[model samples]
Target: MKTKLFFVLIFTTFQLLVNGQGRYYKAQMHCHTTNSDGGYSPVDLVNKYKDKGYEIMFITDHNFLTDSVYVPGVLCIPSEEITFKRHMNGFFLSKNIMPDENFTCQQAIDSVIAQGGLIQLNHYFPGPFTDDNWEVGAPEIISFQNGPHMLEIWNTGTETVQTHDDKSIWDAVLTAGKVVWGSATDDFHPSVSEALEFNKGWNMIWLDTLTKEAVYNALLNGKFYASTGVEITEYQVNDYGTYKSINISSSNANKIKFWGPGHQVLQEVNGSSASFILQSHSYVRIELINEGILGMSNTYAWTQPVFLNNPLHMADNKNDIPYIQLYPNPNYGMATIDIKSRQAGNLKLDILTLEGKFITNVANEYIDKNNYQFLFDISPMPSGFYLLKVEFNDVSKTLIFEKI
Candidate 1:
């Protein structure tokens, strides 16, 4: 019914230290209010979702910010749906913003970033009768090079009308190695009694506290799963030395399907829950399907892909430790390594091939705390992808970069 907007990327490491800190919470990150086109007021909308068992909700009124609004039992995140040629939901905004009369997709995205908000590209798939349906590709918001933080893989509103399935678009971005994540939204505008569109979709966020900051951190770390109806009790991925494996448990799921890079089904298991040896792939996510339930059909649960980064040989570094960033990423031999170390140590920087073969010990020096930058030249090596490893004492981190 509306134009397209953008979000998605998985840039964090997968080392979660679940030392009994976070708990799972139900969240409806996107929804409208009477502030825009929805029937309920902000307070009523929050109360409605709270009654439906949602612990967190974002108002996301079109062109308006609900920053001053609060609901007694639910967390009200300051968000707004920026309506333009394409529509996008900007979350965790420092302040509210309205779209320009002729706002382009990129401009909207830049606006969100300017305000330190995480943006989700809204529904890209429109119904057949809609002006911007699937036949007309979403060119303005398509590229993953500087795309939004996430994409709506399954939208309840779209599902209600039986149009705009975006699995194909999601797979294309994943195949291109963009490191994006998927989200399912209610996009609710009708009354809760209208079960077909109102509480049909949601995000199950894994966090320790029921605070806005906690939710933001979890989302940033890709620590949540999306569902239309099915409930995921547990989802885990562990490396058992030589091989990795994944285990999943869901409520009433008829089947669990594991997908690889190219929309390929790597494995499928029957029943409500199952586990499998993790296959070799750039990314992996599970799709749970169930028969009709609660006047809704084709129940589904989608997990964010487990993006693999090289593991640390020891325990994960404390959360407070600073991370390193490699810039001039696709450089012609010369590059910069920016370090913001929390602790001082003897630093050993080296380059290695993807096969674990040693390339060269680029730098070995005693480094201080705080911010530091080091430059390395790989002019002697051929153009290709390689790992840049920074080791300090017993802790080490690795980053993949390309030489052009």
Candidate 2:
């Protein structure tokens, strides 16, 4: 079944999709209140965070749901900490989830997904000085299906006692072929006067508006960076069909580092600006460190990740995919997919959501021809963005076009 077909993938940074059009808004994904085990009420927490210049927060009290409310200039969403043996958090929730007896971590993760909420494994890695042990390590985390969308890489509530960086765990998960984004939070449990677990950790989300859907989309697509203090001033990523590189600059960072799989420090710079070429590694995420501010330390910011090769995959992708182009991209009507293959094999082309959910099939055939061009009417599909997956034999590539 020969048909017009295919596309090639050129991976780029998050900024390309939203670089000049949008700005970053401060967010707190985890926090507690009197609903569970915190000192402040929902209203009080919202007011305090607004005063701190925060634009968004998910009030995650233990097993208790806080309805979405808007303070003068702040947006609060429904969230909760599923107080299980190994803790978990569900944000942007629509229902209150309660874990019953014999309920497992995978089950809890699915419970959040069932409600269309964003889930994360909270403070899984144990610090060297702490004796607390839970199934929060990568060994068990990678075993779950439909697992968390994010991980609490830096949680001040536990780091105050169990001081450890969860990046090692993040690398392990990425190495195991799982895609879990990194997140940071204050885990606020004290009053402003107590001064503990307040305004210490947060995320900067990229968007043009401050609304529930905007915030949810940013998080759902990894369009945010976890941070303690360091701020990102400028970031850009450029990738042609064959070459790719990324550059970032910040005012507060003393050192800029790019980390790869297995906690490998691929590149490090001493100054506030840095650039890295994405050539061989499967993926690399940026880290910014400012030793201290106001005689204090632990200020850092972590970008989600910029991948040369996607980690959440079935087989180790090879360098065999042919370079091709799709014209009239971000099309409203007619669009064409051209597959220029040198060797003959079975080919399959698909359109999918960025998260890899299949939307429609474009072509599937045994290709004996060198060139297959597909002209399909794209107006039938919705106007949102999606991915173009081209699979030729065992080698496949997902080309990320931010504007579908």
Candidate 3:
């Protein structure tokens, strides 16, 4: 029995993380072959990975799906890197897809889903120059309804050169109320002899049975952790509806950090194992690090974020989601604003563009007991993404709504 790497997990998170029966399979989720721009052929690449101790691998050639190889012990899953205006990897795809420039990003996502595959956004961090205005920009990439949900958090091919990690971008996407899982990959594209560019990152998937179907479902459910080097011996997340408890122990990590919204470190420890009790916030993620020598950067292992079913609010009021409701949430013409809180204070309700620019004042007054039910008219506004912000007490929270 080798080290068990648990894959993506939600409802079955604890079982996969704690069950000694499960083993974590070393996976090279993304790599290229000669079929596209890689220097190594499929056979050579598969052998190279096996030599380096990868239990499972996906040879994701750019715009091409290399034939599944038949290796004795190694698992070669069908995959491809959908290189359009933006880059994405479709894992466990049944067949290769050819998307022309005329195809929209969303269309590519739909195509992958049609094949029961996962569309993971490749290194879109600092590698490419893009902004929110660009249709394929990082911001826009996450806006697609059923779009790229798995982001390449650490790409070794681009890791040593980047000024920042993709964790910031991941945090941004979470802050915007979208759920995404992180993936680390080598994106390797070198020959077997090219030691300099070989293996620097990978995804560790945990499974009881070594099968392609099990691995695919694991990745789909986010049962794995993305790592550069640090390895976790035991990871457990216990979500108890009201509060959550997280316990983790790593063999190589010297430090563990518990992070929350906006990349805030809620707790930090100096040992290999640590526990965190999360009572509030939208979600929490774990980061394990091992310090490097001579003041150099350290290695990291990032676990998928654990979202809270119920959390405390900013103030004595209620949480941003449940307590705040707008009748006809996707309003056509007129709607009713139904909102309340336990505390009473000055209120400021404003509508702003998704870019955080002030649009107009919906209301600014003092309401007794912090209860308000009024009629809101969006018929005069154009259909777009807008923010409905409520500022009361000393803290404020904003909700994104569509005016249709």
Model 3 regions lying over 4 Å from their true place: 1-20, 127-138, 191-193, 294-297, 310-404
Candidate 1 — what's its lDDT? Answer: 0.68
lDDT of 2 by residue, 176-260 (tens): 7766789999888873334657888899999989877678767766788999889999888777535458889898999999999
Better of 2 and 3 by TM-score: 2
Could you tell me the lDDT of residue 188 within candidate 1? Answer: 82
Per-residue lDDT tens digits for candidate 3, residues 1-404, read 11111122111111223345787888998899889989878888888888878889888998998766888789888889988777788876766889897766677776675454667877776544232222234466546645465888887766554234547777777766666678988888863335545777888888888886678657755788998889998988776768778899999999999888887888999989999887878788899988777425577898988777421111112233213434444456665554544455677778778898887776676655444555667777778767777787676766556666
- RMSD per model, one decimal: 13.9, 9.0, 14.6
* Tens-digit per-residue lDDT, 1-404, candidate 1: 22121212122334532225667789998888888889888888889899989988877888888786777878877889887766788887655677777776667665664343567877775565233732224343344223466777776766675433457666656655554568898888873436677888899889877876577657755678888879887777786645567788887799889887778888888888988675467667788988655434677888877644432211113323334545544456556665545567887777788786777776677765555656667656677777777788777756666667
Ranking by TM-score: 2, 1, 3
lDDT of 1 at 176: 57
Kindly provide the TM-score of model 1 when superposed on the true structure, using C-alpha atoms: 0.70
RMSD of model 3, in Å? 14.6
Report, for every candidate in turn, its global Cα lDDT versus the true structure: 0.68, 0.73, 0.70
Better of 1 and 3 by lDDT: 3
